[model samples]
Target: MNVTLRTPRFILRQPQVGDAEPIARFLNDFAVSGNLARVPFPYHLSDAKAWLRTRVPGLPVENSNFAIELPGEGLAGHVGFHPGPQGPVLGYWLGQPFWNRGIMTEAVIASLDWFFSASQAPAVYSGVFHFNAASLAIQTKLGFTQTGRSTLLCLARGAEVEHIDTIMTRSVWKARPK
Candidate 1:
């Protein structure tokens, strides 16, 4: 769908036809793919094409994806919610060049505010790989509490690895300390 969400710095908008090349460029990096479950190493143009094909523009918010775009850098990252067994699951990544700036956190906050405010779901779930301290911190900062752990397949690493699962209820979101 033609959804265009904005944070103070970036535009969370639809992934267009031309994003595949840049998507392949940034995602081909080992650092970017290592923490992800589905992105394969040496990512190809076809891989990007497959992902874009799945993301229909008009899909509802809970089932959609967005390119994290800056005015100058264009597609700097990606973020989105996918359906989970219990509720919606949050996922995101920023290219290595854009790391450590709190940009992903802002994107997550804005998207979830829209998700939580717009939907009637009870809560949201997220899982962070064991070594991804940054992602764990982001989820915690957003009030997601640890639910458990599991070994999930990693397309990049080509194996199942330890993942920390977390959940955040509507009440928790509403009561988050400002």
Candidate 2:
């Protein structure tokens, strides 16, 4: 996989050894910890290293995980796609300090472009918790349409939750203004 994706103000790259300390710090922030289901509160450098070294290397061909970094500003967050039976599943998160800055949306657009160009997949899907309005808005802005709702058992959150599933197809994406 390519190591990096450059956007106007961000670099979406694979996680490296140098990223461990900053990622650990961001993961432990209360604001970031509360919103994400997988990241533990009080996250440690060991956890970051484990995530980068073990989990990241095993991602499949259809999937990609990127560490969002703003040079001179530090690690901003992460974004990725998980290939599913139906299509690719998109996921992303931004550090609290980077919120409301449109960074994630830009990253998503770039990822979508890469997916369409590189893969055979025809569509991309994203699921946002009902209360995550910012995420919903981002997907909508990227031209995804609400396809359905799903009730998922989130073991990490310890709840049966409702999520709005949105989808964007290659046809739709290709028709959009570039």
Candidate 3:
């Protein structure tokens, strides 16, 4: 089932149609969308609506997705896992206003805590475009280690970009700081 995770300052819950407005607004900025592999730049309300349609509820936590909400700010962004060639991949993005405030870091820790506790997967895979040093730093703080590099299509940039692959094994996550 789609799980709802709560942190001291944020709520991680399922995405809904109402979240489309903020999703489009935040992702429309190239600074935000360009770092993401799947989102297109100039992201529109219709695009968010279409993507939200795919977030089927009642799916297991492994396949579930979350809309990151600040207490009074509505949808701040998203963090969730989806199927990848190797295993479940962690993916997330935040509105520019919410950047650098440790919002994503808190949400990610909560999500990973729940994910590792609920599932038996050996590891979770994630990566950032090579230029996204900020994102890479967050990954590093969470004990995710670089696995390799590969070129991946960045829809917003409309070209291939270098991606630094990383993985967090169960043991590392189990030993993470609380």
Q: Give one digit per residue, the lDDT tens place, for model 2 in 65-133.
A: 888989899888888877665878887888888899999999998888877887788888877878788
- Which lDDT tens digits does candidate 3 get at residues 101-126? 99999989989988998889999999
Please give the CA lDDT of all the candidate structures: 0.87, 0.80, 0.92
Against the true structure, whose lDDT is highest?
A: 3
What overall lDDT, based on C-alpha atoms, would model 2 receive against the true structure?
0.80
| Candidate 3 backbone clash number | 0
Question: Which pairs of residues collide in candidate 1?
Answer: 1-57, 1-58
Arrange candidates by TM-score, descending: 3, 1, 2
Please report, as a residue range, the 10-residue window in candidate 3 with the lowest summed lDDT.
56-65
TM-score of 1: 0.95
lDDT of 2 at 97: 86
TM values, all candidates:
0.95, 0.87, 0.97
**Candidate of highest TM-score:** 3
What local lDDT does model 2 show for residue 178?
75
For residue 162, model 2's alpha carbon misses the true position, in angstroms, by 1.2
